[model samples]
Target: MADCVCVVSEFRAGNFRRVSFEVASEGRRVADALGLPLYGIAVGSGVSDKAEELGFYGVDKVFVADDAALEHYVAETYVPVMAEIIQGLNPAAILLPASVDGKDLSARLAARLQAGLAQDCTEVVCENGVLKAKRPIFAGKCLAWCEWSQGALPMISCRPNVMDCKAADASRKAAVEKVDAAVPEARSRALSVDLDTSGKVELTEAEIIVSGGRGMKGPENFTILEELARELGAAVGASRAAVDAGWRPHSDQVGQTGKVVNPNLYIAVGISGAIQHLAGMGSSKFIVAVNKDPEAPIFSKADFGVVEDLFNFVPVFTEEVRVLKSTC
Candidate 1:
């Protein structure tokens, strides 16, 4: 008699992240609609003390599988843990965040349990007593709804920031269960572990992103871009050319193969619009592109296009925004 929605937790760079909150809030919604409980499961090293925080997000239960071996994200190590829990719980549904680590974990978990998984899902709805997952396909050009035939629990992964969560009473409490590894069961294992110890912003989670491209001339010009980003409460991003030139870290790239983003404001400086770049950020609400080339492809997608040199423009633009922000 398990009617619950389970969300896998993400713990990295020393703390819980936005994706966990996004998943918890999302799972809670689906669970509430079906009159089911919401369960939040976290796996990692030194992560047990944070279990209480999950309760604040409306989880009826928080499952923590903290282990030194699980310190880094390894699909092989994590999938079995999730599989054991899901099989035992037999919940109505399970929801995972549609993130890089989350995608890897969800895919393997569903495959092991002989269950189906939906990824990059933008919308989910219930129809004819079955839950429907709406996901984009063909490079996000088209969308489709999917339904599965078997498995007691339907599995889904939600795109970040796609759905706003409904506020819940954090005072509510849930069970905190400490589980064993179900060792030798996980099909995968970690080899080399490398965390991004470098203090740089990840594109998906950054609310403000300032991106640049070929128009910046060369690597040195990127410093101006970084400075502007720093002044504006934003993360520095780059187009493929900028990364290929070794001007910026690949982690800062926003594109299909890199990271897809929908930040509140995306500043594209000197990036001549390429379909690849647009594909990643066209959904951004406010796109401001600054390129001297009047016909640069970036302008077609920008809410405001500035036909001026980035070197000549970014400093002044940064100052204006700074002044405006300070006034308000």
Candidate 2:
């Protein structure tokens, strides 16, 4: 059996997450550089039918483990199955998305396989047939490169939105092999899960994000930001200050203590850009800051800055965006 690059597909809520494609694309890059085949592992209920979609992103084959017990991500069951498949294939390297479930599964799988694991990597590459990864360190203050020991398998989890997702070819199709799920009895089971049904775009996966801070004044003021977010088809985020002030839910907080987001465009409204907050969104491709204070730290990081009161600027901007979108 020849060595190959394997990517674990991330499936949730009956849909494959975008990070799955990004991971696959990164896997393809490494695989090509190493002169190896790119394979994918899809573990989910009824995921077999959708496994072929990975081929569009450059996967040569897909190993599907579809079963009712695998519907929801249970680490106990998933870790064992993933480990078994990986051991059988004995791939040179394994890649997965650094998502909530992906992170959990990757960490457990690495421990089970005794492999060197790099989590939340922003960059990965193949150097001299060895897998090299770069990940953030010190609260996103710096990046560190990682490499596996000669005898250890290289395991990596790429951060969402950091990797480039190539244009998929709809005509491409991967060979699919059905594998037994062979789920074991779980030690614990979730009693219930509360999902956010607010219909807002998921912050981590969004292409554009509009975030607010203490400048919004209160919870009711988020309405203006929400309107702009809707107009821009972006997710709404809040700084730790806003969340701590009870102006926004913890789920919407974006900072070192909250969620890290890397979107194509990030609009910071009324945010002062504390280091903690910048740690979360500093990786954004482009940043636009709007603050009344000329010396707000957010302006220092923003590609564009507007020294104006958000309360006076936001409503007008929202209306302008609405009009521009209407014309389109």
lDDT of 1 by residue, 297-328 (tens): 88888999999988889988878878888899
| Tens digit per residue, CA lDDT, model 2, 1-328 | 4478899998876778999999999999988998999989999888988999999999999998988788889999899998888778878889999987888999999999898899999999777777789999888889999987778888999999999898999899889999875899998866656778989899999999999999989999999999999899999999999999988889899989888899999999999999999999999999999999999999999999999999999999999999998899
For candidate 2, give the lDDT: 0.91
Top-TM-score structure, candidate number: 2
Off by over 4 Å in 1: 127-129, 150-152, 165-173, 185-199
Estimate the TM-score of every prediction: 0.90, 0.96
What is the lDDT, from 0 to 100, of the residue 58 in candidate 1? 73
| Candidate 2: clashing pairs of residues | none
Local distance difference test values of all predictions, in order: 0.79, 0.91
